[model samples]
Target chain A: MILKVENLNKSFGGILASRNLDLQVEEHEVHAIVGPNGGGKTTLMAQLSGLSKPDSGKILFKDRNITPLSTHKRVHIGLASSFQITSIIQSMTMLDNILLAVQSLQGHSYKFWAPVSGDAGMRETALNVLENVGLGRQADTVAGKSSHGEQRQLEIAMALALEPDLLLLDEPTSGMSKEESGEMVRLLKKMKGEKTILLIEHDLDAVFALADTTSVLVDGRILATGTAEQIRSNPKVQQAYLGEETA
Target chain B: MFKFLENLPARVYLAVTALLAVAPLLVTLGSQPFYLDLLTRILILAIAAVSLNLIIGFGGMISLGHAAFIGIGAYCVGIPAHYDIFNGFIHLGLAISCSAAFALITGAISLRTHGLYFIMITLAFAQMLYFTFVSLDEYGADDGLIIYQRSDFNGLLNLENPTTLYYTVLVTLLGLLYLMHRLVHARFGRVIIGCKHNEKRMQALGFDTYRYKLTCYVISGTICGIAGFFLGNFTNFISPEMMDWTHSGELIFMIVIGGTAGIFGPVVGTAFFLLLEEMLSGLTQYWQLIFGLVLILLVVFGKGGVHGLLVWADTRQTAQAQPENDS
Candidate 1:
């Protein structure tokens, strides 16, 4: 397994965000976590990404416990996440955004005298990452001026630049239009076998299309885990989530 | 040459540097020695503003206690000079180290808070330093201290000469401006700018942003401290008043007036502020009241200050010229 979560628990004030949440993601498999609104999908992603601490649980990445690691430290050890609400440096160019991720993985960024733009190798690497996300043509476009769909692509490009072992993508197509969503699915479909992605997605079509394994989360607990066929047939998952949508 | 001149801000920068180079000669020819002193003072404060811009303008760190470094730097010179130590190197070393140390310690705590709280905590630290300096009666306290002789460079350069001092200050400013240019384009600079735009995103991108910001804060303080070293030599006076929050506010005003986006903006802002202060104070005692109104109008209508106006004009010219080229 690339990732293992054991009985993870988190509560905010009086509400429980995660309760005895257990999950496992296999190497090079696209694992999708699907649920209704506020079903603790993001909370589980947050805990796994080291953005928040679980009150009672252990998170193991590559079989080593990473429950107490900070967000940046987890990233350094090959775990990178993309936010649900699309977090990117708006004032910089799309290429520059990816360059930041590339720079981070290369070495310490205490280099003050030499200009980063002059580093031809780093620029090429960043460009290649952008190209992989189909944003090579818009490399010079300021991120804030880019279309929402383009920004989402840039966001994934940034996370991919880290070359992480496991990618935690939270609702990558949340704010995208139908065409944009199709483009995103195609992009992810290309990376399906090569990358281990723990995806939290709302789009059922996307989940069925991309996910190698699907897990149903309900009220901060895993209701069921199976293939698309089994998940669609599972009575518990259908009653808790899929049934609500279909009905 | 014409193509180079097409860039308005670059042209202005070149013209300003050339004028400053000949300013001392001009003052001598006009027999107005007072203008030399005024220009020297402006150059010194411009250095401070430029340093502050590293954090405020570029790094998105709005520190309200930047003048504290100036005060600390001045004291580094004053305290040693009091005991008959005239070594320029020693004074500079102390100034840089002391200011850097102070910034590191304060920044460690202050950077943990964001926005208004960060501003408040920084102000509180400066006030703390101000009071500490005021209570030190051994170093003249609230009354201040004086240096009988300028820092001795052992005949390398003469601070005793007004013209020499002006050139020295000018060289320092130019060197710093070049350094700032190099810095903002470097890896370190990109990280700082990224943090400014979105700290959380930067963190997610595997950057330990707090450490980068703290390092930037220290760099800004150290540069400002160097400016303070020059200020002590020029004014020949060191006092707690030098670090008053109002003085820090004035530094911010200078940066805002010139423009914050460009590396040279603070220098232009400093010049505008001092020259306007000089002209208006000569006209009336209520110069500050008029200054207040002008600043209010500038902030309200002029979004980018003087530098922004220059950029706007440059872009317009480029747009107008584009059609001619196409035709």
Candidate 2:
């Protein structure tokens, strides 16, 4: 397994966000977690991303325990994530935003004397990543000016810039139109095997279309974990979490 | 043609600066001693304004107690010069070191809070410094201090001569502006602005935003301290009133009038403000009332100050040209 969570538990004052939550994601696997509104999906994702620490648990990545690491350290260790609410530098161009992220990952190659505009290698790599998300035409446009769907794609491209071994996306399709959601699903499908992906999402259609394995989470506990077919047919998962029609 | 102007050589900027540096010497249309003195004062204030812009414009830090840093710097020079410790370089060095130390200490505490709270704490600390300076009877308590003469430099520059003094301030201001330009474009500058916009995002991206903010505060204080040194030399006097809260307001006002986006905005604004004071004072003794009204107008209409107005014009011009490209 590329990521292993052993008995993670987190509580806030009197509220339990997660209780004995255990999950494992193998290399190159697309793991999907579906849960109800108050089902602690974001809390689990935050813990994994190192944004918030688990009250008690061991999170192991590549056989190394990272329970005590910081968010940036987690990023340096080949783990990257996209925010649920868009986090972008509004004044800078989309390309510049992605280029900064790429620069961070590329072994301290920041040269203050040379203008980034004329650097062909950096520009070309940024262009390729922009093209991957169909934002090639909007590369020079400020990140703030782009449509919401395009902004979401820019967020993913930012994550891709890190060239992480695993990518964690929290609600990549939230607040997107039906067509935009479909495009996001298609994009994620293309991203499979290029890197390990752990997704927290609610849009069942996209999840069913993209996930190889599905886990049901309810009230901070994992209900079941199985192949997509098994998850689709599980009665307890249908009645308790994923409505009968969706199952 | 537009693209050529947009990518104009840095030499053009350097040339303008060079001309400004030598303007007083080259032009002797009116060689009034008072005019020279007034111009020197404007130059000193311009330096202070520019340093404040480093924090206010580029770093997005709203410092209301900036004048206190200027006060610390002036006293650093005045107290030593008063006591006959007349080494010019050492006085300047002491001034800068004192201001930087103050910034480091206050910034550590003030930066822990955000937004309005940050502004308030900084203002409060500056007031504390102001009162402390006022209580020092040796420096003249609330009355202020007078320098019998400018510092005696060892075989270098004599500040007693008006022309020599003007050039001295001119060189220092130009050096600071150049440094500020280079700083804002560097990697550290980008991170500073990035943190200003979205600190949480910068942290998520693995940058320690607090350190960047504290460093900016120190740099701003140090630069303001330089201005304070010039201020003392220009007036040949220093006082507890130098660190007054109203003086801080004026420093902020200079940045606002100049527009905070570009380096030279503060210089332009300072020149314009002092000129207005000169022209208006000639008209009436009650010139401050008119100055206040004009400031209000500038704030209301010129949202980005004078420089911001220029940027708005440029942005509109670019937006207008977009249709031509589309065609």
Candidate 3:
């Protein structure tokens, strides 16, 4: 197992976001969490990414407790995330955005005199990552000026640049059109087996297409965990989530 | 060569430097040495504004207590000269270290709270320093102190000469501008800029942004402190008034007026502000009323200040020229 969460509990005032949640993500498998809106999918992702502290839980990455690590420290330890709402430095170029992520994993960025733009190795790595995301031609385009689909692609590029051991994708295709969603799924499908991915997705087609094991979450708890074929036929998962989607 | 000259800001930077370089000769020929003195004061404050721009413009740190560093720097010189210590190196060393230490301590606290809270906390720390200086009766208290002599460089350069003093201040400004250019383009600078755009994003990307911002704050304070050192020598006096909150506001005003995007913005802003002050104060006793109106107009209509205006004009020229070239 690459990630293990034991009895994770979190709440906001009276709203239980997580309740004795237990999950285990094996190495080199795409684990998808599907649920209705406000079913605490994002809340769980936030806790996993170290953005929010779980009220009670033990989060083990590689069998080492990382429950109390800061967000950046978790990233340093090879866990990176893409947010549900696309987040990037809008004023900077596409290449610069990826360069920042690549720079983070290399070492300390306390270098004061040498220009970052002059670092040929960093430039090449950033360009290669952008090219992998099919954004090679738009390297110089300001991120804010790019299309929504492109921004979503940039978000994944940035996350991949960290070369993380596990990638946490929170609704990567949330705002994408049908065509864009297909493209995103194709991209994620290409990344299969090569990466350990914990995907929080709403698109059932995408979940079935990319996830090796699908888990149904409802009312702050996991209803069931099984293969896509099993999840589609599981009565509890249908009544809690999938049935509502079809109805 | 032509392509490089086509860049508006570069051309302006060259023209401004050349003009300032020969300013002493021009003033002497006109027999108005007072203009040179005024220009010297402008250059000193311009240094402070440029340093302020590093934190505010590029780093997205809006500190309202920048003048406190200037006061700290000036006093570093004044207090040393009081005891008959005239070593230039000692004065500069104290100025850099003292201001840097002050910035490091205060920045740690101020950076914890962001936006309006950051501004208030920084202002509060500066006010504390201002009051501390004011209460020291031994140092002449609120009335301030007089420096009997300029910092002795042991005959390396005579700051006693007004022309020499002006040149020294000018050189310092130029060196600092170059330093700012290098810093903002460097790895350290990129981190600070990224933090400004989105601190949360920078953190998620694995940067300890607080440390980077604190380092930036210290560097800025130290540079402003250097400016304070020159101010003390130029005026032959030092007082708490130099570090008053109003002066801090003026430093920010200079940056806003200059167009905070480019390195030269602060210098241009400082020149515009002082020249207008000189011209308006000569015209009326209540020059501040007119100045306030102009500032309001600039903020309301001008998107980027004076530097923005130059950029806009340059882009328009390029657009007009592009069609002719195509034809």
Candidate 4:
């Protein structure tokens, strides 16, 4: 296992966002989490990525306690995540955005007076990541000008640039067209066995299509965790998701 | 060759700066001490404005107490001279140190708060410094202090010579502008801009943004201190009014007018603003009213500043012409 979360609990004022949540992610597998809206799926990812603090919990990445670490430290230690709402430096070029990710990973960000665009090494790596995400041709385009799906792809490209051992993708297909969603599914499939991806997804078809194992969350608590086939047959998950979809 | 022509704006900027470089000689040819003094003041302020643009324009920090750094730098020179310490290097050292320390302490505190709160806290700190200077009765209090002797180096680049000082200020401004250009395009610059756009995203990508912002703040203050040193020498006097909140507002206005889109904007904006001030004040007693009207119109009508307007015009013309050609 590459990640172990022990009794993680977070509360925002009167509401509990994560409640005694215990989970584990094995290395080199695409593990997907499917949950209802407002079920604390994103909140869990936020804590795991160190964007928000858990009220009480121990988050261990590669067996090292990461609960106290910041988002950047988590990134430095081979943990990367994508935002559900598409976080990117929109004013910058698509290539520059990815380059910034790659630049941060390299940790020589204090290189003053040397042009970042002229950095052939960082640029090449960013381009490769862009190409991997099918956005190589849009490298010079300002990210803000790109289509919504393209910006989502750019965000994923940035996540890939961190070269994280475990990747957390939050709603990668949110607001995407059917075709764009298929493309993203294919992209994640391509990287499936090569990286450890903790995916939070809304589309059940996508979860069934890509997730090796699945965890179902309801009201900030895990309802079930098993192989996708097992989770599909599980009566509890059916009541949680199938009932919601029909309603 | 085509690339050079393609960048017409840059080319125009180059031509303008070349003309500015020769301005001192032009003053000599015209035998106009007044023009020389006006231009010298403009260059020093240009340097200060360009530095402020680094923090405000690029870093997304809206500092309202920027003039405090300038005042501190000027005092670094003026205070030393008042006590009969005339070493130019000592003055410069003091200026840089004081400005850096001020930036570090104030930036550490101010950066913790954001937006209007951040702006107000900075203004409040500057006012604190302003009042301290106002209380220094030994240093002439509100009446201000005059330097009997300018800073003297070991007979190197005597700052007293008008032509030499003018050229020196010009060269320094140009150098600082180029340096800023290089800095904003560098790796550190990308992070700063990245933070400006979405600090959380930058942090998510593993950048310690707070440290970067603080360092940038210090560098800006230090450079502004350099300008303050030059301003003190240029005027042969210093005052508490130098760091007034209104002066900081003017610095912000200068960058905004220049478009803050890039390095050249501040330089051009400084020229446009200071020259407008000189021209306006000469025309009427209520020149400020007219100046305010012009600034309001320019800011409202010109989205990104004067440079942005120019770019907008160029794009509009091309966009219009392109359809016609295709049709």
- What does TM-score give for chain A of every model? 0.99, 0.95, 0.99, 0.97
lDDT per residue (tens digit) for residues B1-327 in model 1: 478676899899989999999999999999999999999999999999999999999999999999999999999889999999999989989999999999999999999999999999999999999999999999999999998888888888899999999999999999999999899999999999999889988989999999999999999999999999999998899999999999999999999988999999999999999999899999999999998998889878888888999999999998999999999
Cα lDDT for residue B155, model 4?
80
Better of 1 and 2 by DockQ: 1
Q: Please tell me what DockQ candidate 1 reaches.
A: 0.91
Q: Candidate 3 DockQ score?
A: 0.85
Instruction: Please name the candidate that would achieve the greatest lDDT relative to the true structure.
Output: 1
What's the candidate order when arranged by decreasing lDDT? 1, 3, 4, 2
Query: Residue A145 CA error for candidate 3 (Å)?
Result: 0.7
Interface RMSD of each: 0.6, 2.8, 0.7, 0.7
* Candidate 4 docking class: high
**B1-327: candidate 2 lDDT, tens digit per residue:** 355356223334455567667667655555556777777888888898998888888878888889988888888888997788888888898988999999999999999998899889889989999999889899888988988768768859998888898989888888888787777665567667777777766656655667778888998999889888888877888887888888888888888888887888888788778888889989998988998999899989888777777677767877888899999
Per-residue CA lDDT of candidate 3, range A170-225, in tens? 99898899999999999888899999999999888999999999888888888898
Worst 10 residues of 4 chain A by lDDT: A238-247
Off by over 4 Å in 4: B316-327
Write model 2 residue lDDT over A202-247, tens digit each, in one string.
Answer: 8988888888888988889898998888987888888888774455
lDDT of 1 by residue, A1-247 (tens): 9999999899999889899989999999999999999999988988888788999989999999999998899999999999998899998999899999999998899988999899999999999999999999999999999999999999988999999999999999989999999999999999989999999999999999999999999899998998999999999888999999999
Candidate 2 regions exceeding 4 Å error are A106-121, A244-247, B1-19, B26-28, B315-327
For each of the candidates, the C-alpha root-mean-square deviation to the true structure, in angstroms, is: 1.2, 3.2, 1.2, 1.6
Per-candidate clashes, comma-separated: 0, 0, 0, 0
